[model samples]
Target: MDTPQNTALMRALAEVPGPLPTSGVVHISLPHTERFTVVGNHLAQNAALSTTAVGFAVRIQSLPQGTEVGIKALAARFPEGEKLIAAALRELEAHGYLHRTRVRLPNGRMVTRTVFCNHPEALLRPRPADASKRGPALVAAPVSTQAPAPVTAPVSAQAPALVAAPVAPHVPAPASVPAHVPAPAPVTPHAPLPAPEALETPAPPPVTDRPVPAGPLPPAPPAPRLVPPPTAPKAPPRPLPQPRELTPGLQQTAVALLSDLRRHAPELVLSEADIERLAPATATWLERDAHPDTIRQALTTDLPQPVKYPAKFVRHRLTVLLPPPLPGTEELAPARPRTVVIPLQTCEGCERAFRSRTPSLCRDCRTACEQPAA
Candidate 1:
């Protein structure tokens, strides 16, 4: 802020007391509140008042609600006005002088509305359970068929009918010339009723498929129930990986692997994120029981010089080269024999009741049976 450019600009610019040029002579009206705010508030008296942010804040405060606060509009007032307004707005917000709220309209869209405060005590973060949150003070109530009290104006017997009176019957000229009676002035429609009373006015029954009711509508059908949608069963979450213990050997391997990748493609600037994301790929390769040398060779063999987006390329290559997960020791162990052995059977021919490997008879008996009986 104390730079030479700022000092030179300050020196170069001088205030000339005069009215701003418009299409013609013009004037702006301000209430006592706004005039006091401009003159007495921090916007005009603070340390930042020399900066464009203060001026921008003053302008924002001076304008009434619904005024266009776009960058273009602000640029018309301050030099480099758009950027100035943006900075000023941020400053105002940071200083608790401005904040915004999101309001969903009936059309099912959300919009941000800037809430500026000349004497704001708005906080940056609001508590979750606070009773007051951003919304309109009033919400709309549903319409019902129960009729509102009908407004009745006093009826005069001599009052004219709502419809235009029929044109006076033309009379054949009794005399050669007669004075023509001036036609009555046409009546303009009356102004509409105020909106609050308009809603309160009684409406006629809606036309429908059913004939006009002779009696009352069979107590109008009960209001439709708002049934909640059926929920779908949730899928089981994937298991998270267990933390890896970095032994000296494994750490060396990881470092070497990283070193080899960097050597192959030096263009990539590795970060902790790249390391973390790529760690899984390396772990997968190791879990598949791949040799460190093989991994290095696969990466270095087909690598094109000067890889573009090297981190991603390396990630894809590592994933492509990932070996399947290794089987656990339990899966690969031999099936154990039963502890209790069955008694052996003997051959019927030899009167040996040995437990036979062959079904229904001993091996010798089966062999003998298989041979031709002689």
Candidate 2:
């Protein structure tokens, strides 16, 4: 089938240097070999249906029978969520692609039944002659068999043929199908028949807002008790640490440090009574392993010129800026050195056993022996 020019053109198109730039959509449609559903263009290109509804109809058509298509199932399967999926399903129902009805099971439980039509237009087509045997007739009088005259306009001018039309009560077929044309029936002159305009149009069916359950309604749930929320209690203020007791040596050190503060700051001169009264607070600091120079620096550094009350300033600093106590002695103390016992050896001169690096006399014996030698 290839000519020289056609082959060159095909080769050029096939041998694209790289991806070609495209402003609009470029479809690379491939034939689906598996898991494909045939959706008609009526549903796909419907102006009334939303994009979500079209996509949902395609997905539902592709799904295997008995698979869960419930709102929750769809919400879990896709990210659009239940509300949008429900709206899309309603759209499908309104457009004749889907129908949902309630059926009472043999076990006395009610369940929803769903019916899907791939080609919705077939529903409006003429029914077969045996359709009347199936159920009660929708029309009270015999249906007229006369065919409607053909219109000269195109297909779009006429109403679309429905697929899977609901079973009606002895309703006659529409005029669309030419194959079902029947011969005119003989009429008697005694009675004149009514024209098509004179015949009454069937009233529209009643609107059912929701499917009613067959059994009695369940009892109403009891009203919930309203319990008051518990009130939060106010928090109490934190307590300060109690002044620590100190040993006699620590107390003397504290008093000495306080007395030496004047050496650093001459204005920080405290009297004997003042030192004695503030000794305990300083001793508390010392008890917590506070160094002497550190305490002196705290009490003397940055002294206010001509301090009217040095004792009060020192007391306030000592109380407000007291350092936290050091960890316990067990934690702060160094690990103890391992004790090694030396083997006892006999001394060469004294013939007495003594502990030493080499054979030697004891301390007292060595001193005595060395004194005799000197």
Candidate 3:
């Protein structure tokens, strides 16, 4: 090499073995293929990624894809987790080691997909190849057309000018006559042969109506009667829903609130759709955005001495004593229509209700469709 520096460096690099730690993560229990890259040589040590972040990254790697590893869950699980994890992720993303792509899930949810890299070159994503620019297809060259030159014969003294052989002139073939053709039978009028006598076919023996020994028919299953399914007895209709009969949709919302409470406070088991007994109180709680558990607590916390009929009593309390709405709730309420009417604008894509007046996809699906991939 011309340059001494290059020569020396090449020699030094040649002496040094490629990379360190040939073995992969020895822990066999790691879920999925996470162990393959967890401690691989590809994980370059970035100073920005502190010990905490590195720990967090390892934890993240071990987690299954699409798991709910939110900041809140991390904080609850580890000390100083939220801040450390956030900073670490931001640092890794800056170095192109981490990627967050908002992908539309098969279930129609818009979610961020986390793509982690052990070693990222930070290059732009490759684009699809251009069809027009493709190289020509492989094809064998055309076979040689001219016949081989005539082979030379041995010459006597001086070589003679080569004489060519003459080819015979082409002859046309004569038209062919039909094969095995019989000559016309001389147009003779011959006498007809005598008709043969008809053979007699004996008439089939007449089928006699014979008596059959019939046993009694099998006792057919009482021709299966279509008995309607037995339904659970419906509770008496709740007092005609008063003047303000809650719509089916609103009742569903109330029931959902009850279900949420059941998650945290399993003892609060009640049908979400038992709207007659639960709607007014549940609606009051939902309007304020009060956590279901908190609302349940408020209803059950300071009960009067030995309360009878817990469901009836709880319902009464929730309706009568609802906490004040959260401060910013007024702003949120404007987005909801004051008087519920069927949505005017339907989504052009899914034809779902609550599309803006101009007729577009609802917010979630709209974001999913319009979001530019990263």
Candidate 4:
């Protein structure tokens, strides 16, 4: 059976003189089941929103929760540049279809959190209008000409019962008193105060030679416990025993090596004062038959990043990792040679020096001597 509203709509449509115009849009909307978003017509047909903003808003709303809808992400996904996408986002924000806020994460990183609203009309509160200018008055004034019949109806209905009820004995009726009598004037009396001998004064505190302190002065704080000012951290103990008067030549070699350290590791660059100060330690390494390369390796390799105090670091390595002196002859035993070297001899035939195990003529002279006389 057709409902009255639907029937009326059909009749109204039938009364139209001609067929529907073919120029406008026609929707072929189908029931959505799986992956679809419902968008409100207020946003879809909004006159103030630009085409790009409308499309971007729809895309944002359809996206799954936590999906990236930032300007760069959208720009990467679509051909529209970041500028256009950002403008579209701004438009969406202005119209209340989207909100983007920079939020700081718990780990101290900043991120943009976006919120999309499908129905901006419901989500975004419209500015409240001035009551005096736009809204109708909530309270209407009562008309003076109209009688108060509704308010007086209940009282009028109970009038017979009220008139028949017996009045209480304590209750006074309006007509019981004489109308001409005047009321008595109010009376106030003042009482006499007590004699002066009844009042007593408080005694004053006793005087003492020394002034008293509040709460015993906290036991004089135990003379501050004499903390000794923390010993000043002891200044790192300067390289100890100071290399025992190194030679001028040895000192120069050490200084040259120290200055050249920058060639291998740029971070190990040393000032002139630093090089002069560390020269004795470097000379000590050389005195112990430690090669300049070995010193360089020790200082440059495995260096801490940024080497804030390069001179101090070099001093520590030099003092702590100094190699033991080479062994004495008594400590080392001689060993046999692996191979013998041929002695150089002059050839009898050509008088040219050549190496041979046995001193004799050269190969050419030997062959000539062995041949028959010719």
Q: Which candidate leads in lDDT?
A: 2
TM-score of each: 0.26, 0.30, 0.23, 0.29
lDDT for model 3 comes to: 0.57
Model 3 agreement with the true structure over 1-374: per-residue lDDT tens digits = 66457776556555655463467632223256534544644353656566766766767776777766566777887787566777877666665556776899899999777776654542333333432355555444333343434333333454325434334367775576467965446432244322222222344543435544498644433332222222346665333122144556655776666666545544455653454567765665665666666766776576665554556665666756667767775777657557855557877767777825466677777688777762
> TM-score-based ranking, best first?
2, 4, 1, 3
Roughly what TM-score does model 3 have, to 2 decimal places?
0.23
Question: For model 1, how does the per-residue alpha-carbon lDDT over 222-338 read when each residue is reduced to its tens digit?
Answer: 333222222335776433232255455555565557656666556655666676566656655665678877777776676665566766766767766556667889999999987
Query: RMSD (Cα, Å) of candidate 2?
Result: 27.5
Q: What does candidate 4 score in Cα RMSD to the true structure?
A: 31.6
lDDT per prediction? Answer: 0.59, 0.74, 0.57, 0.73
TM-score of candidate 4 relative to the true fold: 0.29
Model 2, residue 358: displacement in angstroms? 99
Worst 10 residues of 4 by lDDT: 222-231
Which order, best to worst by lDDT? Answer: 2, 4, 1, 3
List candidate 2 stretches off by more than 4 Å. 1-24, 127-374
Task: For candidate 2, write residues 285-320 as lDDT tens digits.
Answer: 887878888888888877776689998888878887
Candidate 3: 10-residue stretch with minimal lDDT: 192-201
Clashes of each: 9, 13, 1, 0
lDDT tens string, model 4, 243-323? 666999899999999999889988887899988888888888888888888988998899876688877787788888888
Residue 265, candidate 1: C-alpha displacement in angstroms = 20
* Stretches of model 1 off by over 4 angstroms after superposition: 1-37, 48-50, 70-83, 121-374
